[model samples]
Target: MAISNKVYAMPPVVDANSRLLFLGSMPGTASLAASRYYGHARNHFWPILYRLHGAGVPDASYEDRLRFALAHGCALWDTIASCERKGSLDADIREAVPTDIPGLLRAYPGIEVIVCNGGKSYETLDRHHGMHPEVLRRAVLKVPSSSPIPTRQHKGLEEKAAAWLAALSPFVKPRGDAQGG
Candidate 1:
């Protein structure tokens, strides 16, 4: 791969109150270009989050969407810190450097769940830090990818949202409620 193919992940969106850590494999081309997580118009990440929180629609601006997630104790990040890949697909990824998840877990002890956003993110996390004590203690879930690409099991936005909700409901709280309901 050319040097130009090397893509780096954005800094994690986290805070002291964050209790749900959502991790993707890495940012796709659209996300990288926009300098935001899940920037693709068709991507289901934002929509699913909004639906989970009972927010009728996602906020038009990226910053507002981010704030909403933070308000609900959701933290967004990627498993891969940097990697070389020709395109957005996880299969194209090569020379992957994983992010310091354990360090982040240590820093934010309030985080109780680790939700891997897709197969690649979970695979990388398991391969790299599966045995770590911090990871072992948390509720780690491998959910379907929020990518626009459809699979046999998850073909539509609603399907994806349902799957994500099933995995996240136990940890997620209502929009303004700090305590889990």
Candidate 2:
């Protein structure tokens, strides 16, 4: 496939109450086409999140899902602000421009943890903004990609959920508990 022209990431889904920031590499082809994060049908992102938080169904409307995430103090964004790539694979990204993570952190001081959704997101954060004082102060968790593509270690949704839950449970409260009684 020919490399496409520069593709930009969608604006972050964040707010003052956001306590956990989830960073993906960039929107995949399906996600970009649909203008929704983790839009692909096979991706485990939504399912994992719903399973972990147990509030909304994974099949809920896009807006509902976004609200669910935000209600749980979770924010979502991509590490790469813009890049050229032939397809959805992270390896194909070129001329990558990183998102202003430090700026986001500064704006949302409530965010206590940064969760890299995959290796590319983690690598991008580490390579581009790791040294920033804002980034250095927060906890960063590198979790397995929630993609449907199987790996030797994380071979299915259950495995991915286990890993994600383990990494995020301390910070992500269920919807009922998120608002704080």
Candidate 3:
């Protein structure tokens, strides 16, 4: 498919050496506009990831947020890099163009795990491109989304955002392996 002017940007790169990868469905309106991940203010992706990885709370800047994710050996990306949606709702998407996820695997030879942010991303990824068997074998976590739209019960966090991050612990270790949650 031709790259549409409406096409949103995917992560600049999927770190090959990552042991953990957080996959969301698609970028929201805010994210597309900002050309970054988790740009929505109400979204809890940043805070949750920071708290979960013991990276301390993130600063009020996009640069810091990206640094935090990259530092933890965790890759951040979305299942559908480009999707036609009137709004941020996943259900509203029409013409979806998923990114070259397989290419990322080939490019980053060290990835070993995938953490789906929600059922939508899970279904998309699980149904479309097949992830590395080795990565899926060790960790294929299905966690909640920070998206307020998916209102449901998650682990202990109550809020989907916090719960999602907390759930990622098994796949993503803390900054130091000396402590385990």
TM-score of each: 0.95, 0.93, 0.81
lDDT scores of the candidates, listed in order: 0.93, 0.91, 0.71
- Tens digits of per-residue lDDT, candidate 1, 1-181, equal 5367899999999999998999999999999999999999999999998888878789999999999999888999999999999989999999999999999999999999999999999999999999999999999999999999999999989899999988887777556655553
**Which model scores highest in lDDT?**
1
TM-score of 3: 0.81
C-alpha positional error of residue 154 in candidate 2 after TM-score superposition, expressed in Å:
0.6
Arrange candidates by lDDT, highest first: which order?
Answer: 1, 2, 3
Q: Is candidate 1 or candidate 3 better by lDDT?
A: 1
Clashes of each: 0, 0, 1
Off by over 4 Å in 2: 1-4, 176-181
Give the alpha carbon lDDT tens digit for every residue of 81-177 in model 3: 7777776787777777776666676666566777787778887887677554534555577877667554636433347655665566556666776
- Judging by lDDT, tell me the better candidate of 1 and 2: 1
Candidate 3 regions exceeding 4 Å error are 1-6, 131-138, 154-158, 176-181
